[model samples]
Target chain A: MSHRSFVWLCLLPLAAVTVAFFLLPMARLVVTGAEGPQGLAGYLAILTEPRYRATLLNTVLLATATTIVTLIVATVAGMFLQRHRFPGRAILIAMLTFPLAFPGVVVGFMIILLAGRQGLIGDFSNRVLGEKLVFAYSIYGLFLGYLYFSIPRVILTIMAAVQKLDTGLEEAARSLGASPWAVQRDVVLPALAPAFVASGAIAFATAMGAFGTAFTLATNIDVLPMLIYTEFTLAANFSVSAALSVGLGIITWLILALARSFSGSAVAAAG
Target chain B: MSAQAGHGASVRIEACGKTFADGTRALEPATLEIARGETLVLLGPSGCGKTTMLRIIAGLELPDAGGRVLFDGKDMTAVPIERRNVGMVFQSYALFPNMSVSDNIGYGLKIRGVPEKERAARVAELVALTNISGLENRRIDQLSGGQRQRVALARAVAIRPGILLLDEPLTALDAALRDRLRGELNRLLRALGITTIYVTHDQSEAMELGDRVVVMQKGKIAQIGTPREIYFTPNSRFVAEFIGAANIVEAAIENGHLVLPGGRQPIDGDANISAAVAMIRPETIRVLAAESAPLSGVIDSVSFIGDRQRLVVSGVSNRSLTVDAPNTVRAKSGERIGLSISPDAVRLLPPER
Candidate 1:
């Protein structure tokens, strides 16, 4: 066979898998989205329907908030962990990253054990404030669960970045009369900008598309993933659910791209 | 230009010693004085404690207990580097990559809360002074190596520090660029007249740039003197070998003459010493016609080095003696040549510590 034909032969299996599993399914989903009563306007129904619009806004806001908070907390923790050496420091870092191995359902379950009705927080608050404080079925519970898993992913990237920082740069800044705060603000933070963008994008996109935690605590939460699940599985609204899935993926990807352009290398991190 | 930058401060380091946490000695107890506007260089091989001493003076590292650093009659040992007002240029340049060249140069001034217009004027002045006038708006990553070096120097001087500490500033460049920068740095230092402490392993750099050189070995100072004094009248064997190429011959001294295996060499030293070590710089030894001098040897090798020809002559001493003959001399390997060295040019040194 010719070289070009041989190369094509090598790519045949990969092309078959992509076409069968990915391209065909994606095309079917797109077509199914337009097959609703509103026709192609089913895509526009995502923006016009008040209930669906609210769920989309809620999901976006939660993801953005989680990303911003994750970056702040992780940057501080990562800097401290990378710069200092002490007994049990390695063990502490291992414990912080232990959540990386957890599924979102487990994270939500753990949050329930901490703050659910008839749980530890409810019992403690009942005694202290004479009330059973429960938030396990609310959006706040889902927020807490997202933060739990997002921290480990963001912290590792920030720590790796902090480890590669040049100590000479800090010393040079100090010799030029920069105080410690000034050194951190002007020198160290600017150098870590790329890491922040990359990790923050991952945290944001994960929060936007996450469904397991939302499903576990979906009693009161109206996040887009939970709304899509109800429409498809409970209400049997396949076309609307398909349209919503496409909308969720596009919005998450668009935000990630915007972030990447802003920070140049701010990109989505792996799971 | 130096008046605009500010006056240099007199610095004194008293009995400074450094011991790391692992109990290894990085620098031994030493005392030194640096006058205002004087350039002092610490020259030695790697791990010679030269950088440690510079760090102590710069307040980057504290000395052992009871040691103190003073500036202009004031004890400044307790001050930190940020408050000491010392300018430092590292071997890595360490320019801020996130900022433009002008921003990097103006950073210290901005930290001091200098007004925007005044800061720009000062940065402009430094850019011109360092010959990087057109690169102000460029990013640090976009700059060439030479340009980065100039930017580092300009940034360090922008703050008008009382003393300047440079750690192997040109050691990162190629040999040709290093030599060129050596002359340029000397002229710049002379023009600035700052109390500058320069650390380098290259002896030629020390000779060209320093008003005085401190020769160090291990964790202690071997000798401290002017470049000429250190080169010509080294107090110890280490100083003599570290400064320049010298043929060290071990011999017994009798009546101010060193008795070698193949020749009796006249030296300027005590006449009563039973045994001694003497140093003869290669350039000081003259290769002569075989009949003119008593000391004779067969040239093992002749290397033409453009400006001078170096001949390794055996049998003149127990070890081979190196002679730097002028390039014009027609000499080849395996030829017999007489070697002549003046008594004044031969320096007797104390045996190794």
Candidate 2:
């Protein structure tokens, strides 16, 4: 075979996979979104319909909060974890990253086990206050579940970034009359910005599309994934479910794109 | 050497030693005093504790207990680097890659709560002083190696530090750039006059930039003196071999002359010691035709370097002797050449350990 044709032939598997699993499903979903009783306006129900609109807003806010909180907690923990050494450091890092190996259903189960009616915190609060303080099966419970999985993803990225940081920059800042806080603000944080954007986007996208956790402990909360699940399974509304699925994917992808461009300046400056 | 262009703080470090957590001793208990507006260089090979000493002075690494650092007679050892008000430049330059050139230089001022307008003025002044003008808005990666070095210096000096600590600041540049920047850095350091402490392994850098050089070895201070003293009157065999090229000739002093294998070269020693280890600089020996001179050796090899030619002469000592002759002098390999020397040029040194 000629070299040019050989190179083109090498790409055939990737092209076939993309068309079979991605493009075909995506095109069918977009067409199904408009083939409903409401016609093309079915896509607008995600925005104009109060229940669908509330679920979208709820999911967006939860994902954004999860991303912000994950970045803050993981950055501090990751920096400390990467910089210090003591007994049990290896085990501690392993424990922190253990969530990455857990499925979403497992994380949701862990949250329920910690805060459910018979859980340790509820049992302790019942003894102390004469009333059980259970919050499982609620939005708070889902938030906790999302945090458990998101923290590990962001922490690993931040830890790697912190490990690769040029320590000379901190020394230079200190030698130039920067206080510890000033050094973190001027040198450390800016150096870690790209990692924050990259990993936070991943965490945000994951939270937006996470389904198993919502399925496990979701009764009182209204979210995009739970709504789409009910619409497809119980109500047998394939068109609306497909439309919501597209909305979810498009919204998550758009937010990630926005974050990427926001962080592009940081990467350029660091270059 | 004491031009005193800017405010120069007198620094004294006493009994400073560093023992890491892993039980490795980086520096032995050492004491040093740097004068106001003077540039003192710590000269040694890698792992010789010169950088450890500089860090102790800069407050990057604290000295062990009982060690004290004083600035102008006041103890400042407890103060951290930020509050100690010292400026430092590193081999990596360490300029902030996330900020513009002006912002990197002005960061210290901004941290101190200096007004933005005044911060800008100080940054501008330093930019002009370090000769990195018109590059304020440029990103760090956009800069060449030399420009990065200039920005590092400018950033360090923008705070108007009491002392400037530089650790191999020019070691990262190319040879030609290092040579050119050495002259520029020397001029800039002298102009700032901020009691600078420079650490480097290059002997030429030590000789050129240092008003007084501290020669260190294996975690201990070997010798501390003017560059001329260290060269012309090295107290130990290590210093003699470490700094510049030297032909160490071990021979006995008989009747106020050094008796050698080649011939009896002249000596100006008291002859108290029967055997002596001596250092003779290459440029001190003059070469001529073997028939007219007192001592002679065959030229082993001749390397024609610009401005001078270096000749390796055999059969003069146990090892081949390196002799640098003028470029104008005519010499060839395998030729027997007469050697001329003045007795005063020979420096007697302590025996090696």
- Which 10-residue window in model 2 chain A sums to the lowest lDDT? A262-271
Separately for all candidates shown, the number of backbone clashes (residues 3 or more apart, or on different chains) is 1, 0
List fnat, each candidate: 0.86, 0.90
In the range B1-353, model 2's lDDT, one tens digit per residue, is: 65356466899999999999999999999999998888999999999999999999999899999899999988999999888888899999999999999999998888889999999999989988988899999999999999999999888888888898999998999999999999999998877777899999999999999999999999999999999999998999899999989999888788888887677888885768888888999999998879898778889999999999999999887678899999998998999899988999889887777
TM-scores, all candidates, are 0.97, 0.97
RMSD, candidate 1, Å: 2.1
- Kindly report the docking quality category of candidate 1: high
Off by over 4 Å in 1: A269-271, B1-6
Q: Which residue pairs show backbone clashes in model 1?
A: A198-A267
lDDT of 1 by residue, B101-138 (tens): 99999999999999999999999999989999889999
Kindly provide the TM-score of model 1 when superposed on the true structure, using C-alpha atoms: 0.97
